[model samples]
Target: MLNLLSGFIGLVALILMIPAVIPLLGALNWLFVPLALLGAFIGMLSSKKGGQNFCLIVAAFGALRLFLGGGII
Candidate 1:
């Protein structure tokens, strides 16, 4: 159940992240990173690795975008 929830949230974050990758829109990642982190935290409470791994990868991408944009773009 928790894993399912985490996966869903991660999917949503991934969807939102798509636009944030734009050169001038990278600031959106500020919102995405925390959401992804929440999903990751929830995934961590679950018993499986799938959801956790998914959320972690999403969060990593978000963080990378933020870093590339210098925290604001």
Candidate 2:
């Protein structure tokens, strides 16, 4: 379902952010952070609580990366 897909994508984005502290990958966090947020939003709209909770956790991770990486103030 769409919820699962969104959560999966968010999870992938969270994984991708793992290396974002490196100079080469730092720029990509700009893209990944938003992608994760979008995925979380999509998943949040799902009727299933499980998917919503999972994606929200992924989104939180992405947000943490964004903040630590200086992508957001």
Candidate 3:
């Protein structure tokens, strides 16, 4: 149940990250990274690794975007 919830949260964050990829919308990734990290934390409470991994990947993307944008684009 927790794993499922985590996955759902990660999915939502990933979807939200779509707009953040736009040239001038990089600031949105600031919101996405935390959300994804929260999902990853929740996933850590579960035994399975899948949800946690998914959330981590989403967070990584957000972090990469932030890095590329120099923390603000």
| Top candidate when judged by lDDT against the true structure | 3
Q: Candidate 3 at residue 59, lDDT?
A: 100
RMSD of 1: 0.7
Give all TM-scores, in the order shown: 0.95, 0.67, 0.97
In model 1, the runs with Cα more than 4 Å from the true position are none
lDDT (Cα, tens digit) per residue for candidate 2, span 1-73: 8788787887787788778766556666777877777786777777775656676676677666666767643
Task: Sort the predicted structures by TM-score, highest score first.
Answer: 3, 1, 2
Cand. 2 Cα-lDDT: 0.72
Clashes of each: 0, 0, 0
Please tell me which predicted candidate would have the highest TM-score against the true structure.
Answer: 3
Candidate 2: give the clashing pairs.
none
lDDT of each: 0.93, 0.72, 0.95
Instruction: List, residue by residue over 5-65, the lDDT tens digit for candidate 1.
Output: 9999999999999999889999999999899899999999999968888999999999998
Q: Which of the predicted structures, 1 or 2, would earn the higher TM-score when compared with the native?
A: 1
lDDT of 1 at 42: 96
lDDT of 3 by residue, 1-57 (tens): 889999999999999999999998999999999999999999999999788999999
